[model samples]
Target: MSKPPLIFAVVVVIIAVLATQRYMQKRRQDAVNDASPVRTLQAEVSAKREFPAPNRRSRQREVIAAEEMRYEVYFRPLSGGAEMMFALPEKTYHDMDKGMRGELSVQGTRFVDFRPDAAK
Candidate 1:
């Protein structure tokens, strides 16, 4: 009944609503990706990078935080289109190098696979 308790309840409710919205959005995106047809494109690995995943923990604890690392690979389609950036598994990310030409399989915003050309 007090103002502090009321404020706290409001904050908790807001957080819960936001979390639910985010979860629903993720589900919707998964469905869209599932329905999307995989497209293979001749693309070159343009770049790659790693960044610390978002975390609320302190900097010292970030070293031990779950999902502390996130990796992304950029591909430039040789046929001419805006380059696409995809979040990929660490192993796959490491397997690609800038300027390596290959077939890039993609489903909507999801990354299917990248096979680098063996000859060049």
Candidate 2:
């Protein structure tokens, strides 16, 4: 009934509403992702490059930055099309060589799985 308690109650209600909205948004994204089918294609690594993560090291503090690597690929779908270019992680981008063939399984922006040409 007091002003302070009413303000506190209102803040709590606002937080609860925000949490519920986040939960619903996540659920909807998951549903849409699930409904979308995974697609696979025969692809090859046309190019590869290693990019050093930006260093923000300060003399006042010693900091370590994560190592991130990327690659560009020419994806030729089994159905056939112009080579598509994309970048992916280097750790998972193993044994990358020009014209290194492989099969790529992908969902949205994430790489689901990749197998080297030798495996085929």
Candidate 3:
């Protein structure tokens, strides 16, 4: 009924809608990836990144909670192509490094596997 509450409600609804849309879009992408043929190509690990989970803060700004870390690996096709980044499990992410050349298996935008070249 009040302006503050009304504004809060609108903001919450907007956030919910955006979150739902993102979830649905991700589901659609997963389905598309599932239908795509897995392709293994020569590529190199061009970069790697890790995002540490943010700590939740209370009204007093004290840390309240923390989340799991997220990791992504970037690849560039050896033959030349646009680079792609994919989220990877922690262990696998840790095992990879920049400039490692090898086979990269992918389906659609999903990362399947990366096997570094034995010589490298």
Candidate 4:
């Protein structure tokens, strides 16, 4: 092949690679955006995961992790509609269980509060 044709082919390959990367990234973002609500009362603590300590060195000079044992709460999807599981905290995870079923609050994928069934 001629030098000009070879150079053009290389450029085309580079463009194709870049386009593919962009498309994949968009697809990943869409997956997150499509998720409406990842939490429901019926959701149970499917699993517990350990997380590293939070960065307390902030401008506020405050702390988030009070205990050495940090955990992430994983909620089982309800009716498989959401298809997205979320994590919060150890306290939140323990608050919700199979026996309890009620309102569960989540703030930015973190468990805020869990209201158990009053009837139960």
Report backbone clashes per prediction: 0, 0, 0, 0
Each prediction's Cα lDDT score?
0.89, 0.66, 0.87, 0.58
On residues 2-120, what C-alpha lDDT tens digit does candidate 1 reach at each position? 46778899999999999999999999999999999999999999999988876765555345546668899999999999999998888988888888999999999899999988883
Q: Which structure is stronger by TM-score: 1 or 3?
A: 1
- Backbone clash pairs for candidate 3 read none
Q: Residues 1-120, candidate 2, lDDT per residue (tens digit)?
A: 646778889999999999999999888877776777897888766666555544455333333464443455556565666656556667665656666777888775445777877644
- Best candidate, TM-score: 1
Provide the RMSD of all predictions against the true structure, rounded to 1 decimal: 2.8, 6.9, 4.1, 9.7
Ranking by lDDT: 1, 3, 2, 4
What TM-score would every model get versus the actual structure?
Answer: 0.83, 0.48, 0.76, 0.37
Candidate 3: TM-score?
A: 0.76
Best-fitting candidate, scored by lDDT: 1
Shift of residue 2 alpha carbon in model 2, Å: 30
